[model samples]
Each structure stands twice: as C-alpha cells, then as structure tokens.
Target: MFWFFCAALVIIVGLAILTPVWRTRGDNGAETAAGFDLQVYRDQLREVERDLTRGVISAEEAERLRREIGRKVLEADRRAGEESPAARRNSAGWIGAVLALALLLGGAVWLYEREGVPGMPDLPLAERIAAAEAAYDSRPSQTEAEAAAPVPDRGEIDADYAALIEELRAAVAKTPDDPQGLALLSMHETRLGNLEAAITAQRHLIEVKGPDATAYDHLMLVSQLIEAAGGLITPEAEDELARALQLEPQSAQGRYMLGLLQAQNGRPDRAFPIWRDLLEEGPADAPWIAPIRAAIPDLAWLAGQPDYTPPKTAMPALPGPDADAVAAAEGMSEEEREQMISGMVQQLESRLATEGGSPEEWARLISALVVQGRADHAGEIWGEAQTRFAAQPEALEVVRKAATEAGLAE
Candidate 1:
C-alpha cells in the first residue's frame, strides 16, 4: 500500500507539471513571436533617428520610417492579444492526460489487490523455529498410547566382532577427546547394544561438533537415546530433543520424533494431532509418512477421537542422502572440487595414524583414499584391516569394498 501511494503521487506530480505546458503551448508560441517582432521594430526606429541626425536622410523620411515600423509593432501586439490562453488551450491533450493517469492508477490498484498479499506480517526464521518447538511442548503427553507402539527387534550381534570392539574401546579411551573416534564409537556401540557406552559416545559427538552442530546432530543424539531405551523416550533424551527442535522447529524428522515421544509418554491427544498434521503437510512420499499414516487411526483411538478418517496417502520411498547432497552441491563444479576433497582425505589419514580411531574411521579412510585415486594406499589399509578384524568378516568387508572401488581388489 505504501508503494502504491508513492507511485500514485509521482504520476500526479508529473501530470501537474505537464498539463499547463500542453494547454498553453500555442499561446506561448504566439507571445514569443510578438516579442521578437517588437524588438526588431525598436532597433529600426533607433537607426532611423541616427540617420536623420547625420543628414544621411531628411527628417521627413526618418519620421515615415518610424511610423511604418511602429504600425507593424502595433499589429503584432494585436495578434498576440487575440491569441488568448483560452483560445490556444489543448482540450484534447488535457482529456488524454487525465484519462492516461486514471488508467495507470486504476490498473495498478486492480493488479495489486489481485496478486499481492494485503496484510501478512513477515516471520523471521529464528522466531519461526522457536514457535514450532513451543507448540510441540504445549501438547498433551501420550501416556495411554505407549503400549501398542511398534518396537523393532534387537537381534543377536556377532560374537566374532567382540575382540575388534575391545580394541576400538581401548583406542577410544586413549583418545577420549577426539570427535571422529567418538562418532565412530557411538555407531558401533549402538550396533552391539551397548546402550550406556553409545549414549556417552553420542554426548561426546555432540560436544565435539560444538556450536556448529545442526538440528540433525541433536536429533540423531535423541535417536540413540530412543534405541538404548528399546523405543522409549527416556528423560535424558528429552533435553536432546528440545535442542534439536529449537534449532529447526519445522524439521520433518524432528516433528515425527516428537510425536513418537508423546506416544511413548502415553499422551494420545498430543500424538494424534502431531502425526495427523505431519501426514497432511509433509511431502507425499516422505520416508516418515508411511509409518505415520499407519499409526494415525490407532493413535486416534487412543485419543478417544473416533472420527479420524485414514488418509489414503501412497507408499513410495523417499530419496536418500546422496540425492540430498547432490542437490546441495548444485552450483559447484566437481572437477575443481576434487583437489579440496583430496586435501581433506590426506588430513583424515594423518589424524587416524596419530590419534587412532574405530573400524568406521578405518573404513572412511579407505573410502577417502579410493576417492582420491590412491589405490596403492587403499590396498595397504585393506590388508591391515584384514589382519586387525580377521574374526570379524563384516568389519573387513567395509575396507575390502573401498579397495575394490579403487581397483585394488584383484
């Protein structure tokens, strides 16, 4: 509206300047011609008087010349007076100008009303995230709904990996402050069902990531807690979840997990709305939607809201991490970026040697070396890994795969 008013004011002031000029165009021209003719007559009259004094012409001749010039000046004055501003004013131009201004202003107002948002206030990103977390926290706890929630089986872990696990544990203890070691330790510890150890490792991971840690990092920590509790939300996990949601209130995964937290706490009233809203608003093929759609009706029952009609959302799997990374790297040139990635790979290799790391770190090193086209180095790592995890074939497979990618498997 401010912009509209500004534009209108500019046009009106322009029209005001131009309208009088257009109307008086003919009258101004006539007055200018009259002034020029009067100046010519006055100059000739002066010459007539000078000639008479010098005796170049008689006084009688000079008088006749003066009278003739004076008559011509008077005639010019009469004509200028006859051409009044009213007579010379352009009525047609005045009409056209008024019509043009009206059209411009009217069209602008019409288009603005049709396409522009009238009174919507802008939402800053930080405020938006805070609001979302607050909304989630305000909802009821799903205590009554906890019993029927799905729990995935924690199948038996291979006993052969026990020795390798011990080695990694000792290596981590020696390098307690290393971020890479902690993340790697956390992943494998979770796989081995070492809940407390994994939780500790995850805390170290969060600490190492520090201020740069994103919502996804905090959310992952919460996930590790849920796993340790066999699909329950321990009080310890709530703090991590709060941090995640505070970072990104609109995070699809975070919201879904919040619903899970509510369900585990037996707050069906809260869980039902969270899941239902997420299902309706999220992408049609988001990975979390399928499970959410399935659970909505049962969650509704627990909420004592029987009118919940199940949405017929489809079952396509969501795109994975590779697609997401590719999307993020859209404007970067792969050829120029290879050198930077190679530098990082060298640094990782150096760190692993000096600080020591988990099997995951070794696997990452092999992969980075292969990506850098260092097949010889990758092969050496794979050989050492074979000796280190001889009993754990699964662990060796990670390094072996990277060796194959580097063309050293033969």
Candidate 2:
C-alpha cells in the first residue's frame, strides 16, 4: 500500500513537471509562428529595399510596402504574445487573456469614439435635407393661394411714385440754390416724361453755375429729352444755349447745342459745318460719334454742293499773354501786370457782347478773362473763334496754340 501511494505521488509530480514543458512547447510553437511571420515580413522589406536601390520601384512605393509589412509583423507578434501556450497553461495566463480581451474591447470602443467607426457621418446632412423638405411641404397651400392672388393696381403703384416725387420736391425746396438738387430734379422729371420741365430746370442750373461741364452734361440730357419729346429747338432754348456757348466756346456741349440751334433755325448750312467739325475733332469712340455718323448719311450729298467747304472750327484758345503783351509788358510789376490783364478782360467782354473786335484784341481779352476767373467765358470764345475762322484753320490753330501756351484754356 505504501509503494502504491509513493508510485501515485511520483506519477502526479511527473505529470505536473511535464505540463509546464508542454506549455513551454506550445509557447515556443506560437513564438516560432510569430518569428516565421516576422521573417516573411523582413524578406518583403529586403525585396522592397533592393527594388528601391535598383530603381525598379520608386521611394514612395517602397516606403508604403515596408510600412504594410511592418504593420502585419507587429500584428502577428501581438497575437502570438497574447495567445502563447505557456500563458494558456498557467491560471494567470487565462486571467491575463480575459483581461487582454477586455482591454482590446475597451480600446476598440475608445478608438471608435475618438476616430469614429466607418460609414456613420452622413446623419446631419440627411436630417437637414429632411427638415427643409418638411418645412417646404407644410406651406404649399399658402404658397398656392399667394400665387393665385391678383397684383395690386396702379393706384398703389402711384402711391410710391407720389412719395418719391414729394421727397425730391422737399429736397429741392430745402436746398433751393443747390445745383445738384436741381440736376436731380431735372433727371427725375425726365424719367417722369416731363421733358420741358427738365430742360427749364437744367437751364436754370446752367445760368446759376455759368458755363461748366456739369451744365453741359445737364444740357446734353435736356437735348436728348427734348429730341425724344419732338424735333425743333425753340427760340428761348437757342438763346439760353447761346449764353452757354458764350461761356464755353470750345465745349463739346456748346458746339452740339449750336448745331441743333442752327439746324432748327433753317440753316443746315451752319449746322452741317459745326457737326462736321465736331466729328473730325471727337475721339473715334466718343458717345456722340454714333449719332453724328447716323446724321452723316443725311449730309453726304451736301459734300458735293458748291457752298460746302467742310467748314473748319478752331479750338478755343487757352488764356495767356499775347505776343504784343509779352513784348510790351516785360518790365511790369506783378500788380501792374494784373491791372493790365483786368483792363484787357473788360475790353474783351465788352467786344464779345457787341461782336465787334480784332482777333488780336479778342485774343488778349480772352486771355485776361481766363485770368479773371472766367475760364468758361474763354472756352466759348475759343469755340466761336474756331467757327469764325473756318477759312483760316491754320492761322486760328496757331492763335489757339499760342493762347494755350499762355495759360488761356486751363
């Protein structure tokens, strides 16, 4: 019985010892599997490196292959470490496996929470579109009713127009002498189909500001409005334009007005010359060139007539010292020179009003008028000089050049 007991104890001890060796053998098998996988990965890495060195594969491709192989090797190593036979043989190993599984599950959940699981990010877009469609569908009956309703009548429309007119009228009344207000009034009247009122307002503004580009712009608007109303320039309109020309002779506005005035006054002869001169002087892309060209077909036959000489208008002379003044007044003081200029301006204004003066006196007077804050007056004289000296274009050109050099135009 003692021998039997001893034999049983020895058997149990032997089995216990062998169990750990078996577990070690299983662990070795797992380790060998992992090592084999590692070797395979190392082989792939070496192949990629060789390909890169030989220029068979690009650096980027080799790097990607190496990274993939490394990831696979690392996963195999981790699996082998987690599931070794030695770990399974020991009670602690089983406990470790449970803990590892728990850790893996928790890590997976954490990763999913942090980096997101694949294919679940489109929820917001779908929800927003659904909400929009629902909102749109909810109001369909109201939308249909609104679409079927009749538009408001003209009385309602005129209420807004009347309000606008009152606002503009009040603005004009508040700033009675304001040229900008008057111009706005003119434009408003024009849009409202009141061309005559537009013209009158513009004319009043011109008289207030004297001859200027702003006045010319207003006049051009008036001219277009009037032509739209009907043809023929009225006598009062002509007189007002003549005053404008007197203020700025070389002004395109002045010349354009003069052409209209002459055409309406039964003198196409005069009008044709002015229009031709403007056409020659204007830029190729000038806004008025189109209208002037359209009028040209009507005047092409005039070119063949005996009285037609393609009347040349001179450019307005700029303000400056005349040759005689430069020569005779070299020894004068600044004050004395100013006094002389003042006297010359008076004489020129007087002669221009009367239409009786030599070109030399006219030149001096124009120069002096420019010096006396009458640049618009000088511009008108220059325009007139161009028309009057149509037969002497070169001489008038020389006179204009000299006036410009003497600061007459600026």
Candidate 3:
C-alpha cells in the first residue's frame, strides 16, 4: 500500500511541472517573439487616424484620443525600458542634464552679483522727504518769534557753529583754495559776531568759490551787518554781491540785504523799488516776507522824511571768559572737569545768595557753559537764577532768553 501511494505522488509532481510549460506555449502560440503585438497596435492607430481624416470624428476628439494613447504608450515604453538594462546605459544622458542645471544656476548667480537690485526695502522715499522737510520747518512747530531767531546751541554757546568756524579755519590753513570752506567759515564768524572776520572770509570765499549759493548767502548777511554797524560797504564786498546776484538772479535775501544797505545810505527810493520787486516775486510763506511787508508801510510813512538816525548807545565789547576758569576748563581731567563745573555753579549760587548775578554776568556764565558744552549745568544754573532772581524780571528774562537760545529750555 505504501509503494502505491509513492507512485501516485510522483505522477502528481510530474504533471505539476509539465503543466506550466504547456500553458506558457499555448499563451504565446499566436504572437511573435519578445511578448509584443506590434502589428496589431500599429493597425489600431492607423484606423483611428483614417477615421479622423474622413471627418467621422471631430479634431478635438481625435486630439484627446491621441493624447490618451500617447500617454499610455509612453508609460508602457518607460516601464519596459526600466525593466531592461537601458536605464543603466543612460548615465551619460543624466550627467548632461546635471551639467545643464549647473549652467542655469551659475548664470543666475552671475546676474545677481553684477546687478545692484536691492534685496530689501529701505525707508520709503516720500516718508524720508517728509521727515527731512519737517526737520527744516521750524515755523509751525515753534512760535513765530522763535522761528524768526537763529537756532541756539547747547549752552547758548553756539558751540556747533563755533566748532564749524574752527574747522573751516583749520581747513583754510591746510588748503587755502577751498572756497566752500572759506564761505562756511565766514557764515560761522558772522554768527559769532565777528563781522570784520566774516567779511574777510566771505571776500576770500567769493574770489575762490566763485558761484556758490551759500557764499552768496554769506555775502548778503555780511553786507547787512556792515550796513548795520554804520560802515560803508567795501569795493570787494560790492563785487562779491554783484557776482552772487549774477549766479542766482532771483536771490531774495541778496536783494533785501542790498536794499538795507541802500536804506542806510539815505537812498530810500533805491531801496523801495528793490524791496517792492522782492515782495512781488517772493512766496507768501517766505521767512522774510512779513518783515518786508511791515517795513514797506513804514517806508511809505517815511517817504519824505530824513534817513533814520543811528542810535547812540555804544554797544559793549564782547566779554572774554575769566582767565582762571578758562585755564581750568582747558587743562582739567575728566573728574576735574566735573569739579570745575560744580565750582562754577557754586560760585553763581553764592553770588545770588547775596545780591544775585548781574544780567551781563548771567549772559557770560551762559556763554561760558556753551563754550564748555555743559548744557545741563547751564540749565541748572539758569533755573537757580530764576528762583533766586524772581524779583528781578530783567535778569530772569535775560537768563531765560539765553537758555532758550542755548537749547537748554525744558
């Protein structure tokens, strides 16, 4: 019985092996090699194209079918190609693609490096312009009277202006041909109340700098100062202003200052026409417009009147600092500087303890503080003066004005 069972198992195993060969032969019997039906597919595609050309299918319909068939064929081709050794053979083609990508990246980087295209936004142009304009427009923000005055420095010292003057002087010493520097120096000297020095600097500036706008401004300002001091305008000053007028034909400040000279020289008629022309051409919001208009009515009233006589009050000479304090401030160490400043404050306090500082002394102290760049100390001193000298309005007012001009006001 065991031998019969073994014989049946061998027969079943033999049939299992032979069955696969038979089925494989049968499945491939009607096809050619490589398991592909190439002729059948070719015939099917040709029949679809013929139908489209014969108008049996619409163009869009033919296109859609063509796309579908193309997608299927391409997918099949890829699958077959992947299964074969073709994918491995195409390594050079992949390298070519990599090289193409590298070339594209290199070109992009080169363009970016060469061009100045900003990578990010800065402050907007309009906002920057508005901020700049706001910085210059002191009229609406400050009181009308305050706006009329020059901006003061830290301790009523006009330190920045003085520094600018010193720098200009140094620059002129180094390079005498620097006209812009000379003109700037002239402006600074004028503000420092050194009219003769200012006029000399401006004369040099006009000769060297030639047609500068600021030089022109300095020339006008210097001319006005000369006329105010009851001095005749020098030939050099006259020539400088004439050149400036040529440079800026519509220079309102120049015209006004020239008119001031004319008025002072007892030629009201000459001054009147020049002023009238400026008033006609100037913007209503111009800084000098209101003053010019005010002067016009006064000029009309004084048409036939003699030129206004100069005031006889002899202007006091500018006071220099106390020698000891000047030397100490100049020579002191950082700690010693503070001590010197404190001592000055104490001296002022002690002075006020008795009869209080004179207005001139207050002005001098404010000037000293400004020269030393001690604005806070100056301010504290001013506050103390205000408290102690409240009964002396003249002194308080003078100190307060000095403080405001020095930019020490709270």
**Highest lDDT among the candidates is held by which one?**
1
Which regions of candidate 2 are displaced past 4 Å?
A: 1-162, 207-225, 303-410
How many residue pairs clash in each candidate at the backbone level?
9, 14, 1
Candidate 1, residues 1-410, lDDT tens digits: the string is: 66677678877776786667575665556666777888888899889888998999997898889889989989978877875463445555666676776787788668868997766556565565566566556543333222334443333333556667788899899998888788778767765555568778888878888887889778767766665454556566677888999999998778887887777555677888888988888666444565676678889987888888977766443222355555655756887466556666777677655543445567777877776666555655655454333223344455557656656553
lDDT of model 2 at residue 68? 89
- By lDDT, the candidates rank as 1, 2, 3
lDDT of 2 by residue, 195-282 (tens): 4566667666766676454535544443533333233344444554665566567877568667755544444556677878887886
Task: Give per-residue lDDT, candidate 1, residue 341.
Answer: 62
Each model's lDDT comes to: 0.67, 0.58, 0.56
| Count of clashes in candidate 2 | 14
Q: What TM-score against the true fold does each predicted structure earn?
A: 0.39, 0.33, 0.33
Candidate that scores best on TM-score: 1
lDDT of 3: 0.56
> Compared with the true structure, what per-residue lDDT tens digits does model 3 show for residues 133-223?
4543422211232234343332344456457657778888898777667756665565454545665675676567444446445544445
TM-score computed on alpha carbons, candidate 2: 0.33
Off by over 4 Å in 3: 1-168, 211-221, 224-236, 302-410
Q: Itemize residue pairs with steric clashes in candidate 1.
A: 141-267, 142-265, 142-266, 142-267, 142-268, 143-265, 143-266, 143-267, 144-266
Worst 10 residues of 3 by lDDT: 138-147
